[model samples]
Target: MGRAPCCDKANVKKGPWSPEEDSRLKDFIEKYGTGGNWIALPQKAGLKRCGKSCRLRWLNYLRPNIKHGDFSDDEDKIICSLFASIGSRWSIIAAQLPGRTDNDIKNYWNTKLKKKLMGMIPSTHRKPPPFPTIPLRTTPPPPSSSLSSLYNDCSPYYTSTNSLTGLESISAAPHNFLNTSTTTSLAINCSLLQTQDILLSPLQYYPVKDSLIMFGGDQASCSSSDGSCSQISYGKEIKQEDMGLHQSHMISNGFEENQRFMFDYGHNGSDHSLNTWSSTDLKPNGYLGNTALEYDLEEVKQLISSSSNGCNSFFFNDESKTQERALYY
Candidate 1:
């Protein structure tokens, strides 16, 4: 079987919607409300489009009282922070932003920010340097009875005395492994000593020489208090081939210091403008939401434009992915 069609797939209107349809959706929604469920909305609103289509139309276009125009500095900071902490949860990201949609935010990240990030990589095809293997204790000491051992059972170190150097022990009795490794379950009492087998997320530890990949976990990026990653900056002495990767690592540490900085630079104007808009109580949907819709309309427009132009998608598992990339921030 071929399968069902979306709105008959024949006369179904595609591309840009007419102003008349926009008016109908706007007027009907204004009067009767969207009732929260978009699928049944066309029937209730008496529109020619399907529910999903209606939802998209309203979310992407017709929704009014929108803040249109240029992306302010705060938007940039939020984009960086949100992307760093959350990879591609547009809805979750949109919630943090007052008047943006998931579709809109997704589009901006993919089209604009993605290009900005990739551009930071130099044109020279220099091979990135090999990542240094962190010198773990050459020999892992025997596990104490209190330690839950690794299945790998690879002992590269041996304890010399009853006293563990803390960094050389395998059975890290005093180590709080949870604070270190998300993958490994080695427990230790921090009061005794720090665990040697610290696990770093692919994002947390990108080698500065390689602009091709960023690696590390959320903790590796910054303090886990609010899921914000940090950013660090290296001087110009670093080679161009390594700047992107180097900046990526430094950014995680450095950016954390300037989390408030990005906001202060980018958002002060937006905050004032938003407060003015908020005074009107002009809802994006015009009726249904308590606050404005939790999505970025501008981001949605950009996404639609990019998709129409055959652009790649930039999604987040959460906000951390974007925040981890320093240049983008």
Candidate 2:
């Protein structure tokens, strides 16, 4: 069967939008709100256009209150928090940022921010996602041997464990780590040593390992200071790492067994809400580490109010404010 014609494509005015059409749509919405009935909107707005077209033009381009210009630092926080809360649902996030659109934001995220984040992650951690293709080879390698070798190539051999009861709480609900409020990008890689999984040394407070050595993305910029692990903020290296793992003996001697992988939190140096709740170190605000324990929406409202004035507003709650202050120094 042939495909049906589009509602707006038949005997309809199309192509470059005229100023009259723009004015009609704007004035109609201003006077009587976006009625959500696009099919009827063009007639009401007195424009020779389809409802879908009007909706797209207004939502993606001409919304009056839309914030246009480079995204601000605070907007970055909102993006991170949204990513942590809901992975890649850019449309939902755009709803929160008044004037933004899902398409524009999604493009910026994939191109610019994603590149910077991939830099902080290790090379080994990111495996090229599998692509689908039917093999035409007359005689394929034995399935078992091929599968075993692949495992040997990308086996996860290292796992980092943190003892804070709070991490235990956070990990308990693996879903909560991606809560609506925090912005954290998690990428981990484990390089194989002869012994298999390497137990991370608790001796170091924080550790950064390079993981992306195979495909030649970004390397070297993925180290961490053991000291800052105690804080919410994580750090990165100044330059990219050298990519020498491709043909090194590390892969030849069946010693591909000795190769290393990368892991990353993609955590920029933002002060996370305190998670520490121990009586001994608990601040007046009752936080555990950087996660907030008790706070109110009014405080959030207050911070949001302050942010409008082009100021650096702390987290909406008192405990968050304290951590933000400490982060300044």
Candidate 3:
């Protein structure tokens, strides 16, 4: 069966309402409400207009207290906010603003408010994010060419969206980059940092002999005032001694047999929140003498298979970091 008629379109008049038609429709609705059925109202009121046309004219214009045009600032803000949240649900948006009609709002947004919103283009794409900003405290020598090449390549590692606690926090490099663990990995390369008393170091680290370098710990961290004190700051360089470990020290710590393997962080840098991590001494390879570190500067990338059922972390998210940042470069 075809759709039932709401009214006889053949019998209904269409086009702009004249004064006489408006008067009659207004009088009928005031004396007797729509009686719960718009489809039959026009015929009962003896108008040559469709029930929809009568309903629209009455509700959009003739109805008592119906507001037309001249949207205020508060109203515009409401429109923009709701548009962002719910997206173009005009009728719902209309309900939030007293006396505003959905049709009026829909038209105003399309015709005028949309243009005003476009002018705020610069307001949207905020500060560069997902990385910490570094302050220029002292100019250390440029990072070594190999370390520079690693950053340029972005790899030899897993990227956990985890905000880095330290280069020292890395558990260990996978046997290769293809490890199926969801754990995020970061690869660290050392250059050097010159010491300043006032500056709080973001991280001070030494390249591990054959393991992922750990940050925020004594084992992986370069100590201040020691001859091997160095740092690996974000996008910057600091020279650090390799664990201050002499062959005797490495042997004593039982580290010689497993020269390269997983790094176990005994810390999350929580203790260093005071930010006093800095070193005054600059030694090329710490007490290891002329022994060079076996290092790779490639960042390893891996796809995250699933998100966590993890608890709330103390680490900063991307948005908060952006807001708190003073400068990115």
The candidate scoring highest on lDDT is 3
lDDT of 3 by residue, 1-329 (tens): 99987778888899999999988988888878788777788888889988788878876667665677698755665564344322354655565555666678878876655534432122347654344333321433233323223222332121222221212212222332213222221222211101100011222333433323333222211111111122211221212222222223333442222222111121122231121111211132211112233232211110000101121111123442331121110
TM-score between model 1 and native = 0.37
Q: Compose the digit string of candidate 2's lDDT tens values, residues 1-329.
A: 97765455665677878877878778888778667577777888787787677777776666554456677544544453343323354554554454566666777666544332222222456653343222222443332222112222222221113212112212222342233133332222111110121111111122233321111011111111111111122233322211122212322332222111222122323342222112344333222222111212222223334443444233223333332222211
Candidate 3: deviation at residue 251, Å?
A: 48
Query: lDDT for each of the candidates?
Result: 0.36, 0.36, 0.38
TM-score of each: 0.37, 0.36, 0.37
Q: After superposition, how far is residue 165 of candidate 3 from its true place, in Å?
A: 32
Count of backbone collisions within predicted model 1: 62
- What lDDT tens digits, residue by residue, belong to model 1 across residues 1-329? 97575555554466677888889888887777777776667767767677778777776555643345555544543454345333454554454444455677778877555433222222349652233222322443344321112101211121112222323322211223212222221111111112212111122222222222222222221111111113222211223333333334333442222221111010112222221212133233212112211212223233334434542132221243344233222
Off by over 4 Å in 2: 1-8, 120-329
Superposed Cα deviation of residue 27, candidate 1 (Å): 0.4
TM-score of 3: 0.37
